[model samples]
Structures are given as structure tokens and as C-alpha cells.
Target: MSRIRIGAGRVTAEIDEQGAELCSLRYGTEGQPGATELLWQAERAWPWHAPLLFPVIGRMNGDRLRHDGTYYAMPKHGFARDRRFTVARHDATTAVLALRDDAASRRLFPFPFRLTVGYAVEGSRLTVSYSVHNPGPGTLPASLGVHPGFRWPLPGATDKRGHTVLFERPEPAPVRRVEDVLLLPERHPTPVRGRTLRLDGALFTDGAVILEALNSSSLIYSAPGSPRMTLSWHGFQQLALWSPPEADLLCLEPWYGLPSPIGSDGEYAASPGQFHLAAGRSRTFGFGVEVSPAR
Candidate 1:
């Protein structure tokens, strides 16, 4: 069993095998403070933290796809935090877990890779590192990212229904698109309101704000004046805003790739945010969230 103890306010969670084939994560025996650490929340209260999508949301729906004659099926989101993994190492403020692509993974994901997820706590910020190893030839395509959901009611979100997810930039970028599949973005960013910006369920009329190149790299979610936390997505190329119709939590995602829209090319070839790793070569992707002090 692997246990994660949060450093800040004191919260813990235990990850172990359960009756269901899906792994299970549970919080500490005693109650926790604030909201449990990012991963701890999923282990305890939110066992299902959005799956089948790569870095972004909405899985492509096929295990394998024939892209330009190549076949590959990504297991919803790239297999990482879900599959049965062993604790590579641990400490009071940091831990590392690793998972191998076995017969099960090979059948669905047709790629040989090793995923190592580590959490390092530094004061109110945690820097996560992902080291992926590609052991196959013929080039392999993959995506990576951070899907951390903050406990809402965030002091004072909004009288309105949707969350006022704000970015640190004054003007939007000129390199994004608002297509249907959620893949490669076109240029020209949109305003922060209306159907295009509605915070309701997956009713994504107000296409996501693709911050391809904004002045700052951090985005904060809060009421208006009262600030909750400003998540700094370091090394992250894109930010995705999503939430359930009436759910109390909001997810601020920093992604490496968004799935191509329906009827689009599943093959990462010529795709933005698409990554290809050569055999024996290693690749890394990372993003962090900084929990700021309350004013």
C-alpha cells in the first residue's frame, strides 16, 4: 500500500488494491484540513478525477485508431495515476510512484513506456515531475499534463452559476482555435463571458481560452476580489477550464495536448501539442500550482 501525507495543513491518503479492478485511494483515518493535497483528494473523496482524456478532457473513444496507416489506442488518459503502481520512494513531503506497461497496457496502448509520477512539496507549492521512457522503435506519440481540482466555495466564487476562472494576462493570445474536438487551437482568443465562456457543464459554447502565449503563465479562480489560490502552471503550454453543472469543485488543467475534435486526425502527425519520442530516448513534462497567502 502507498500512503501520501500532505505537508501544508496536514492531510493523508492511502492508495491500495480493492475489490474493483480499478485501484482505490482513501484519505486519512482522521479528518483533514483545507482540502486534501491534489492527489489525496482523488484518493479519498473524488476517486474518479476525470479519465480517458490526455492532459485535457473528453477521451477520443477508441482504444486504437488507424492514423496514416499507424495503429495506437491511448487508454483514455495516458496510463499514469490510475494503473496499479509501486511506491518507488517516499518521505514526509515527497513521494514517487511508478507503473509499467504490461500485457494489459500493451494490448490497448501498443507502446512500450514507463511512467513515473512524483510529488515534491515546497512550502505552499508542489512541483510535479513526469519522466517517460520510450523503449520501442518506429516513434511513439503521447501526451502529458496536470489535472488538479481545487475545492470550491473558494471563499467567494461568484453569485453567478459559472466560476470566474481568470488568467493573468490582459489580452488573449493570437494562436488558438475554438473547434469541436478540443484538439489543435486556431489563432484569435475570445472574450471571457457568454455561451463561449459559460461555466456550466460540458456545454462548451464559449470555447476554452487557449493561452498559447500570454504575458504570464499563471491563472487564478476566485469570487472577484477575495482571492483563493493562484495556480502557476510552469512548463505547461495550455490551460483548460471545465466544471460540472452544479459541482462544488473546479478543475484548472495544464495540458501538453488536447484531443483532436471529432472526425479529425487522431494521429498526432502535424498536430499541435503532439509529442513524439524516439526509441531509448526519455521525455519529460511538468506543471505546478502555487497556493498563495490569503489577503
Candidate 2:
């Protein structure tokens, strides 16, 4: 397993080859230390730091996908996070990892594609970018997303609920929830009150809070006198917030796709939030996070 480190100013990040995942992000300088942890440590509650979801996001109904006339079984969130990525480039404050389709991937996706993930640090902000290239002669249908779990209480909150998420703008519309832990073809009332949603484990009883049509591209996770983190994304169509009520973490996810809908045609291409790319074409998506020092 290979891991690369990148840093600039007060921000430092560690990326792992196993998943091309950002395993650690620390803020502040050395000496008179005032270090802060911005990313969760993979634990038994959920053994993932920040897993990049590619080819597919969330689960396919019955773990199956129908393309053309045949049905193929696919694992939840596809397989990119479990595969090792080759380090294509690395420097003091930047790194890039690449994953290419092979026989193994073809069995699941049946398309020739390449996924490149880049990480860079500047001051207290870190930017993550993804590029998807369709190299085959046919259209490529796929999804991509970023799932990063931050410490629930942050750096100074007294309790998890003491922390809250502030949207850049108010979301007055109802949201959707997964049924029985599976995606449903309906929308439900959102738990957010105007622009702020307080953090609490009980709020996840029905799973993640999935919001679409977000008018804002930025979000703030913070608590009184605590280190505040801002997550900004562009070109993402949806967002999902989740964490087990019993766990001390909160996931702020930016997604281009969601789980396969229930009671629908099993065609993977028809899945909600799926993207299509013509042969030889490429698409790019990105998000960044800036963490301020603890108060």
C-alpha cells in the first residue's frame, strides 16, 4: 500500500493508494502546537475515511444492474474504492492518482474508461478534483461522488448536537430518504430548518438526508468556539449527509448520482443522477474544503 502526503501553509493531507482516499487532514503548524483533525479516522463503526464513489453511487437494487438485456450483479458503490490506484504524479503540495478499466472492471461496468483523482493543498484549503474519460466507441453511463466524514463534535464542540451544518442559502423544499436503506422513487420532508441543520444521531434513523437542487455550492460545519470547516463543490447534482447515530462522525457527501430507484426498470443507465458521456469525451468535477483554526 502506498500513501502520499501533501501540504501547504497550515494544511496537510495524506492520500492512500488503496482507495485514492484522503485518509488524514491536519491543520495548524508545529512547535506551539494547535493541531486540529478535519477528517475522521476509519473505525469499526464505519471503516472508511473519504472514499471516492465512481462508476456507480450507492446500491443497485438487489445488487443487480440491467444493461441492454442482461443483468449483472454489482457491489454497493461499485468497486473503485477497493482497487489500488497508480500514483501518476506527486509533489510537495499536489498528487494525482489514476485508475484504468480492465477485465475486472469490465465485468462490472462493461466500458473502457479512466478515472483520475487529484489532490492539492493551498494555505488552509484543499481542493479535490476528478476527471472521467470515456475511451470506448460507445456511450459511457456512470456516476461519481465524494464521501468525507468529519469529526462529529469538531475541535471544540461539547457534544455532537452542538455542531451544525449551515447551507450557503436556505433550502425550503422537501428532500428524499432511502426506504429500508434503499432508494425510493419519492421525496419526503426535509429535516433542515431554513439554512441550518443541527447534528444529532437520532436524525439518521431513516438513513441519510439526501438533498437535490441545492442553490448553494458551499456549506459550513461548525459549533461555538470550534474550528470551522467550509466545503464547497461545483458540478455536483446532489448532497447526502449521514452517520450512524452511535458514531462520532458526520459525512458530508457531494454526489453526481444516487442509489438505483426501487420498482423501476433495472437499467443502470436509467438510474437517478446517472451521467452519460460520448466516446472520447471527458467530464470534470471538483470540491474543496477550508478549515479555520480552533477558537
> Which of the numbered candidates is closest to the native, going by highest TM-score?
2
Name the top lDDT candidate.
2
Q: 81-124, model 2: which lDDT tens digit per residue? A: 99999999999999999999999887887789999999999999
- Model 2 steric clash pairs: none
Q: How many residue pairs in model 2 have overlapping backbones?
A: 0
Instruction: For model 1, state the Cα shift of residue 140 in Å.
Output: 2.5
Q: Per-candidate TM vs. native?
A: 0.71, 0.96
**Error in Å for residue 17 of model 2:** 0.6
Q: After superposition, how far is residue 18 of candidate 1 from its true place, in Å?
A: 10
Deviating ranges (above 4 Å) for candidate 2: 30-34
Worst 10 residues of 1 by lDDT: 18-27
**Residue-wise C-alpha lDDT for candidate 1, range 1-295, written one tens digit per residue:** 3345534332232333211011211222334443433332444444554332332233453534445667666445555545666677877766776766789766556667777666666655655677777888757677766655555555444443545566666544453544443545345545553222334554444444455554557766555433445567555567665444455556666776655555555454444566778988877766555554335
